[model samples]
Target: MIENVPEKAPEPITGPSVVVLDKQVPTVSDVQQEEARRQTKMDAAVAFAREKSDRVRKLAASQQSPFQGNSTGKVIIPNTKVGQGYDLFAPVDKKKMKVLFDWLKLDPDAFINILRLQYHKNPHHFRSGRIYFLDHVFSRIWRDKYPEFKSSEPDHNGCKKKAPWRGVDDIYAPVNFKNTHWIAIWILIPKKHIVIWDSIAKHISDEELAEVMEPDQWIIPYLLVECAGSGELCVQYTLKPFTYMRVTAGVSQCRAGDCGVFTLMYIECHALGMSFSPAFSSRNVKAIREKMAVDIFQEAPESHDKENNDNDENVTTYEQ
Candidate 1:
């Protein structure tokens, strides 16, 4: 075997052996294209579902609705029931009244005027006259109300500066004689603005009014007087720490007139920290209140007729 054995045949390479070492790398572009396709399919499904839902909702609303296309051309009016018997002057207890007076820091005359306005048989008669008197009263009360907060004090540099704790001085009263259903009063404070709403012929409690103010903070005393037959009155302070101010009644029905007194008051308070001066004179305020009242009462019949016609149109359109 050693002498003449044939050379062993080289074993042939068998089965699957690792010959070329090609790295099994995944292409990023291919993965991204696949993902993009999946996302596109998902988006299409979502859009289709949304369209189907909207169509179903529209169909359901069409079958059951009464005023589908009448919103643009009609003045809708709410029906008032005869003799629903709402009390215009709801009596307040002495304790509640006292709390209100303390909260507002009102003087005796101002307090009396508030009471008189609340109890008056005809609020419009006192609208102009009382507002002037109240303006003077408010000026005096505001001077006395914020003595500590308004006073200058020595700061870290030994120079006098206005105290950091300040209260809002702007007050707004929006009386709508034309719309005697409700009255709104606005008070702008350094920290926030408050709105008080009272039913024209109803009484609102002090507790309810307090709810309109920010909680857990010192609130500057303010008063809201609502004469259902006249207008709403608010006594507030100005940016000048101790200055008293007032805003007259505003009518919301007119597009130009609906400046959203409440919204403006809030914005001003938020931006400037609750201090503002009166923008209108007392006489102007009174005049506006009187004019609005006359307009409201005189327009009642026409308003009712317009409402009826609008309703008829709406019903007809919906039926069609």
Candidate 2:
């Protein structure tokens, strides 16, 4: 019945076959699906970080405020009126406090003055006036010389103006470089070092930062000399060379908008002579922001109380 070939295997029945290749090429759909998965993972990670940050903020906000008295939570600084420029004693309304809420950017009034108040509160912890947080406008004055401080004048007029830098060991000045980023310029007068604290230092070149500070190196020393000569800038002025360096170590922010907060923290840590606490990272920044707002809002009256606490060794008046 069967030939030598046997009954031909019923002609091999096959539909459109998947020709298996050693390596299959990915289709556009495959690529798209893979990309979508990657994106979803990233979104999930970001959401988790944000959730953790929010929890920390809420917990800290619920704790008892260190400040005494029923917190009005109204005026940040009483008596002094707002819109009088960036005065250290200027009044800040609730709206300014709102900026410290929800990761909002801090204006000079909100941060610098709050810091001044905090430092002013615990004077025994820090040497009064030894650490000066200059107004953000200090940079502007440095760039566009004030008429009173014009180079042509050669002197601040023998009238003996107040030199805030008098007896200051560290000057934490916020420099808004190019109107884009906020950075801290820490001038250690004794160390003769101009240390830069920037959240995005890695993204910038040492050369660029040095260039931006070149003018300051000369102007600052000159100003110090001028003040020491005229006003109460009592630090030992050696006129020696000052070294400029950018801080590349420590916790840095993962986002761009956090530079303002980071700058404030840098000043705080350095002023306290403490290394950046683990609590000062990007995850805790929201908490830091909330605490700052609370400290500012509640401590509005602390300035007056501080002035009255002259006999209390734990507190001392910040004399300019």
Candidate 3:
């Protein structure tokens, strides 16, 4: 109060103040806001990826086969879920069906498994991969008129069918291929004819197909012919000269895995007594997948059938 002091000078600024982060950094609400932002970005990315994937798949499918689309020229995606049906489509189930598709390399046990399932699923169903089993000239005689020739699982394990050729009229053989291929030998019992209907005419030889499916057997004295020191004639078994005709038209599988779809459709058409047409090759693999899933869901036993929904997580891996 007596004397005025010099005004205090302001302290000179140095640098920016350092912020210390403690355990209490970022409050709960702040973290939640950041997470929400991240989730929004993730959702956008997922949508973009899904769109691109769908487009590519569509293009690939289009090139493989022709399919009927909506009026806007959009391929109609079938309704997977019906009253009760469908799980994984065909392409997704490829691994499960790989062995079945590869008739040439399928092991005995694997082949029997399919037969067992087919046997149980629908006894009268005309459609099955088993029909191709008859490609062999000598298959231990599924139901040979004589019990001596009749064959069964080792030690006679499986049940006998009503007839040797139960639930089959055509042999649908889908060949693993560079592009695609399906060949069938239509067995007309009444006509006593075995006609090869290959999309790629003569692409597969009769002997080769027959050899691939024939049951394994030790060389028996009876089968061995005494021909110039001995051997069976004409493919190990004496086959009656059945009329052989090759169907070389309209039936074609143009891409990988197309054999499965085309063959399945062929069987369906044959079951319904429809003439073979170009539509089969045109029914793209995607639709085949959807249709197959639906068929499996509807036809498979309830115990085997998971919920008829498109939950990829619930896919049932077929045992090898």
Judged by whole-model lDDT over C-alpha atoms, candidate 3 comes out at: 0.42
Residue 170 displacement (Å), model 1: 29
Instruction: Write the candidate numbers in order of decreasing lDDT.
Output: 2, 3, 1
RMSD of every candidate to native, in Å, equals 26.5, 22.3, 23.6
Clashes of each: 10, 0, 2
Arrange candidates, best TM-score first. Answer: 2, 3, 1
| lDDT by residue (tens digit), candidate 2, 117-226 | 77887866654467777756556656654334433433343322233334667878787777678888888777778988888876567677776776566556655665
| Candidate maximizing TM-score | 2
**Candidate 1 residue-wise lDDT, 1-320, digit = tens:** 45886789889978887766456765789789989999999999999997765552223333444756444222232123358597779685779654543322221233223323332545354322222211222323333343443354534433232222222243443333222222334444432444443322223244533432222112232111111112232333222222222222331122222222222222223233333334422334334333433433344323222233322423332221
Of the candidates numbered 1 and 3, which has the greater TM-score value? 3
How high is each candidate's TM-score? 0.18, 0.54, 0.35
Which stretches in model 2 have alpha-carbon errors above 4 Å? 1-104, 127-129, 146-165, 230-241, 301-320
Give the lowest summed-lDDT range of ten residues in model 3: 219-228
Greater-lDDT candidate between 1 and 2 = 2
lDDT of each: 0.35, 0.64, 0.42
**Model 2 RMSD vs true structure:** 22.3
Model 2 lDDT, full chain set: 0.64
- Candidate 1 regions exceeding 4 Å error are 1-24, 51-116, 119-320
